[model samples]
Target: MPPDSDPTEYKVGRLIDKYDLDGLGQELEDRWLGRGYESQSLRSLADWFNKYILEEKFNRAGEPPMDGEIDNIYRLLTDDEVTSGMRLDAETALEEKDIDPENTRKEFVSHQSVYVYLTEHRGASKQHSSKDRIGSARDTIQRLQSRLIAVIENHLEQLRNAGELTIGEFTVLIDIQILCEDCGSSYSLTDLFDRGGCDCE
Candidate 1:
C-alpha cells in the first residue's frame, strides 16, 4: 500500500477480489493518475466499469450472454429515468437467462462504489490533476457536490426506514442557477463559469 493509502477495505475492493478481476485496480489507477491522460469524472469511470469490466465479465461466461444483454438489463434495472415497463422487461430478460433478478441485482454497484474502491481500497490518488487555484476550486466543488448527494441519500433512506414518508425510486437534483438581474436571464453555475462570467454591458 502507498504511504497515503487509507486502511479501510471498501465494498468495491471486496467485489474485485470476489470476481478475480486481476490488474483492474492498477488499470483504474493508471487511467486516473497517469500523466497525459484526460481527467476522468465519476460518471465516466462508472461507464468504463460497466462497459469494460462488468459487461465484459458476463460476455466471457461459460454461456455467453446475448449481445448487449447485460448492459441493457443492468441499465433498465438501475437507471433512475427508466420506466416500470423497462424494469419489467429487464427482469423478464434475466429470467430468460436462468438468472434470478433479485439475487443478481445485489451484485450491481454504482459509480460512487467504484470511486470508494479506487480511493480507499486501492489507495489510488489523483497525481495528474492541476494544483493551481482555479483547479483546486473546481476539485473542491466537485467533491462537495458528491458529498451533498450522499448526505441527502442517507437522510432520505433514514426517513423511509422510519416510515415518515412514502416514496418510490427517486432522483436527486442539485442545480445551482444564477439569475442575472441586469439581463433578467438565468444561467446554471457551470454555464456562467464556462462563459467567463455573464454577458453584460
Candidate 2:
C-alpha cells in the first residue's frame, strides 16, 4: 500500500502496517473474522471503525480537536493505558467476590479478564454458596458489561451525528461466558444473569 493511499481504502491490516499498530490489527481481525484470515465483512469493518474511533481516538472528558484527521483517528487499541485501568477495575470486582484477584489478574491479562475472573471463581460449594451472594456477583458483572456496551453505543451515535463515521447502522455483540466448573458446563453470561444462577446441580 502506498503511503498516500486513500484512508477509506485502507483495510484493517494495511492500516495496522502503515501505522505500526503491531498486535492490534490481529486482535481486531480475530474479533471480526474469528481465527481465520477470511475477507472482511461490512459488519466487521464498521464495528472496528466504530470501536477504533470511539474507544481509541475520541476523548470522553473533552471535545475532540477541530484538526482531527484520519491519521489522528488510527491508534493502538491495546495501548497499555486503556487496558490497565480496566484491569484495575476487574481486580477490584474480583476481590469483592472473595476471589484472590492477584492470581486472576496474572492469568487473564486482556480485555476478557473480567469474564475470566468470574469463571475461575464460580466454584462456591452448593452447601455454602448463598443465593444472595451469587446474585450480587452476577449483577456486578452484568452492570460492567452493560456499561461498556452503552459507552461504545453512545460514541458510535455521536460519530454518526457528527458525520465522522458514515457507515450504516450496526450493533455491538458481546459474547461472554459463565462456567459451572463442578459440572463442566458453560452458559452465556446474559442468560445466567437473567436466570439468576446456573442449573449446575
Candidate 3:
C-alpha cells in the first residue's frame, strides 16, 4: 500500500526541506498528521508563518547591511551645513532691518523645526545676496536623495539575485516612499511600480 497523498502535507514538507526548518516541521507534522488538524492543515501552517516565522526566521535569514547608509543620508540632510545656510539668510534679513540677530535666531530655531524650515523656505530669498549658497544647498540635497535611492535599490537587487526575496515581496517588506525633488511630492513603492516613477517634469 502507498502512503496517503495530501497537497498541504507536500507543501509543508517542501518548506521544511528548503528552509531547514527541522524543529518547526516536526511540530507541524505532529499537529497536522498525528492530531486531528488535517482539515485545517495549510491554514494552520500559514498562520504560524505569519505570526512567528516571517519576522523571526525569514527576515533574520537575509538582513542586509544598509542601516549605516540610511543613517548617513539622514544625518547629512539634517546637518548643520543645511541648517546654517537657512539661518544665515534669516540672519541677514533680520540684521538689515536692525533686528537683534541672537534673539531672532533663537526664536526662529524654536518656532520652526529643521524639516519644517527646510520645506517652507526652500532656498534663501531671491532678493537676498545668498543665491549661490541656496543653489548649492539645493544641489546637495538632490544629490543625497539620489544616492540614498540608489543604495536602497542596489541592495534590493542583490537580495533578489540571491533568491532571498522577489521584487514584489521586497517592496512589500520595505514599503518604500520616494520624494520628488522638483515637485516636492511623495510616492509609495506600489505607485512607483505601477506608474513608473513620479510625474514631475
Top candidate by lDDT: 1
Question: TM-score for model 1?
Answer: 0.59
Question: Residues 38-79, candidate 1, lDDT per residue (tens digit)?
Answer: 656555565566555445445444546667766776688777
Tell me, by TM-score, which candidate is best. 1
Could you list the CA RMSD of all candidates, in the order they appear? Answer: 6.2, 18.4, 25.3
Full candidate order by lDDT, most accurate first: 1, 2, 3
* Per-residue lDDT of 73 in model 3: 27
TM-score of each: 0.59, 0.28, 0.21
| lDDT tens per residue, model 3, 161-183 | 99997765221112247788898
lDDT of each: 0.62, 0.45, 0.40
Candidate 2 whole-model C-alpha lDDT, 0 to 1: 0.45
Q: What lDDT score goes with residue 146 in model 1? A: 56
CA shift of 137, model 3, Å: 70
Q: Compose the digit string of candidate 2's lDDT tens values, residues 1-201.
A: 112333222233333444455666334444433446553332334434444433332233233434542222222222345566665664454345454444322222223322222222222111224656765665576457746866887899899999998866554546677789887767666456546667766
As a whole number from 0 to 100, the lDDT of residue 87 in candidate 1 is 94
